[model samples]
Target chain A: MTSWLPTLQTATPEDGYDLAVKLARVAVKATQPDAAVRDRLRPEYAEDADALIAVSHVVATHFATVAAANNYWRNRT
Target chain B: MTSWLPTLQTATPEDGYDLAVKLARVAVKATQPDAAVRDRLRPEYAEDADALIAVSHVVATHFATVAAANNYWRNRT
Candidate 1:
């Protein structure tokens, strides 16, 4: 039971996508206990899947780039 | 990233609810390994939230009724 549960209980199908995205963000927190990931979802709370997916892609890409940079540093050293 | 990811990637916002519902079912399976709950979601896979909420209400009502019945039987004995 979340703060959004009441709204979800009352939302129309047109609004269901937004509600579902909110639930999905909550579900991600509920599933993945990673604080960093949780932080990523917070500001994006009102965002739809397109926005969330785009942010996720950015986060993942940044992480991959960082990892690649570290690997490059290790190889150089 | 399950079998539905490909479809989700391509689905319009109109289809996102159904897709999100599908993902929610998979997520419940992924999250809750309870076979009985899993079974409940299975038959209702294609159902929308309205349909799911209805079935869930029915199941909960039936469960509560059975529990009440058992309590009554015990009290009588």
Candidate 2:
């Protein structure tokens, strides 16, 4: 979308879900912040860091679960 | 992926992300629980229902953020 946020790669749904998790993690990296993105998300983020932090975990777990499911199926074949 | 879980439609990354949110909510539907999934996710979910409920919101919001971006580009064209 906008050039500000880190982009999630999307080769396929399965792969994209996995990538979104990674992108979110990168966005929250302690060492570096995308200035434009920080400005863009500032309002809600300043108000609710807890909620934003919580999702970084949830979406990561959700994608992992989906990835694990794919692995489970691939092994069956 | 499995028949037991709600399937996400995957055409592209942008669209798939949106669909993932819908699938998650469907999986958590109050009326019908996916028996197989409930069993699979029992350990974590049984321990904490709050986080799972919260991701249902995050992923949805994340998808909407992306969709708005796509529209932002489309409108400019």
Indicate the worst ten consecutive residues by lDDT in candidate 1 chain A: A68-77
Model 2 lDDT per residue over B1-77, tens place: 44432323234566658654653443233212345543554455435667566765656655544443244235432
Q: Which stretches of candidate 2 lie over 4 Å from their true place?
A: A1-9, A32-53, A56-77, B1-7, B10-53, B62-77
Error of 2 at B77 (Å): 31
So what's the TM-score on candidate 2?
0.30
Give the winner by DockQ. 2
Stretches of candidate 1 exceeding 4 Å from the true structure: A1-77, B40-77
**Against the true structure, candidate 2 has what lDDT?**
0.47
Worst 10 residues of 1 chain B by lDDT: B3-12
Q: lDDT by residue for model 1 over A5-49, one digit each (tens)? A: 663332222233234344445646678889997777554532232
Across residues B1-44, which tens digit of lDDT does each residue of candidate 1 receive?
A: 23233312212333433443343333233334466754554555
For model 2, which pairs clash?
none
